[model samples]
Target: MYEDHARIPPPPDGGYNLNALKPGNIRHYDYWPEPPGPQTFGNTQVIFSDHEKHMVARIRQADAVFGCMAWLTNYAILDALAGLEAVQIVVQKEDFLRPDGPGWRKTKLLRAYKALDKNLMRFNIPWDVGSCDQCGDPSIEGVRCMGVHNSGRKSASPRMHHKFLVFCHLADGYPEPYAVWTGSFNATWNGTRCRENSMYIESEPIASAYAQEYGTVAALSEPLDWQYAWVAPEWRIGS
Candidate 1:
């Protein structure tokens, strides 16, 4: 649990903006409100580094977790999450690299992917790379470009536009139990930089639903279809 670490650490540069969405509050950067000195609201904490930082810290405190992100560009964040008991991450297909062109763009993208491959192989974590030609239903699984080719309505730029985490919280008295955390944030800097919201809920029904969805997405993944520049040895393409 988070009993040892300081859950309420110091705030980020701009601090927490409790009301960033009120009226035109989030519109202009210069007009953003400053923390009227150190602030606290009950036990609620705000991490200013973007949603991924909060997620990494939270996952570190959990017994286990399942994660799904549309974009996977942050190696530092992924490296932290690799220490978790369990992890499942689904990202865009290798085509995401095409947009980066060559040189440093491609090199950096491959480096980040190699980090993912290392975590999956070394820790035996469940992670896949996927992307579709077009977008699909946000409510359903396999919206990412790697979505199982929908023989029905194939298109380009199918995006996995969801960001969610399911975990079992560890406690002193009760058994580690299931909980869900989801939001409009990716595991990237854009998640924290852009205005986004995340929801944390713990319920058997909700957990079960998301867990099943995670499985569905994994099943739809074609690991051998698209290969990263630096792929795990165990993931060598199958004939």
Candidate 2:
């Protein structure tokens, strides 16, 4: 897909027409490692000038704003949509799951979920859940969350692999927001100490495609033969 674009016609001047030599395949250009130059560094700086402000103002006033991979800063995006009349939220199950078992962390998550639900309901917004095939145990459908291995082997791993999903949302006419992150970052205070980067963009096509893929995975989740680690049933509730 990295071919060059079609060449332009030669100019009337006798001088060699460089435009005529333009590569026909626009995709052929090498784009690895974005061209380097002086970099800007600081916090709370006015990066946008009057022209930029005017342009963005028009854009924001028009219809929608799309964003992606916002990670830890996702809460800010949610706050932006909170006042809207209605919004649709698509989120990965792991985003709400507690990594340290069912303790204070899990309780906090449940409470947060309840709060979010209440807030969204007030605005007539709805939140949807999405899961990956890797979640739960494979031996029995929906049995994986119970923390049991499908295999009879007594030495099976104890922890179940939970699928992480990106959250997306749409408010007003704007497209849904999406965020993704990697590494050791979890939904915990300690995880926030690690280095991380996230981006936000506005694009309907991208959001739609992601939402569709998430829907497909949510549908395909089923029972399998994968082994799962088991934890005490008592730990499944509040700490």
Residue-level lDDT tens digits of model 1 in 43-156: 333333246656677777776555556676666676665565444566645554443456886677555544443222211222222222123221212122234222344575
Q: Cα deviation in Å at residue 215, candidate 2?
A: 1.6
Candidate 1, residue 82: how far the Cα is off, in Å: 1.9
Q: How accurate is candidate 1 locally (lDDT)?
A: 0.48
Residue-by-residue lDDT tens digits, candidate 2, 64-150: 222111121233333433333322232222322434445775565444433322222211111112222323331111111223433
> CA RMSD for every model?
12.7, 17.4
Q: Estimated TM-score per prediction?
A: 0.54, 0.32
lDDT (0-100) at residue 197 of candidate 2?
A: 25
lDDT of each: 0.48, 0.30
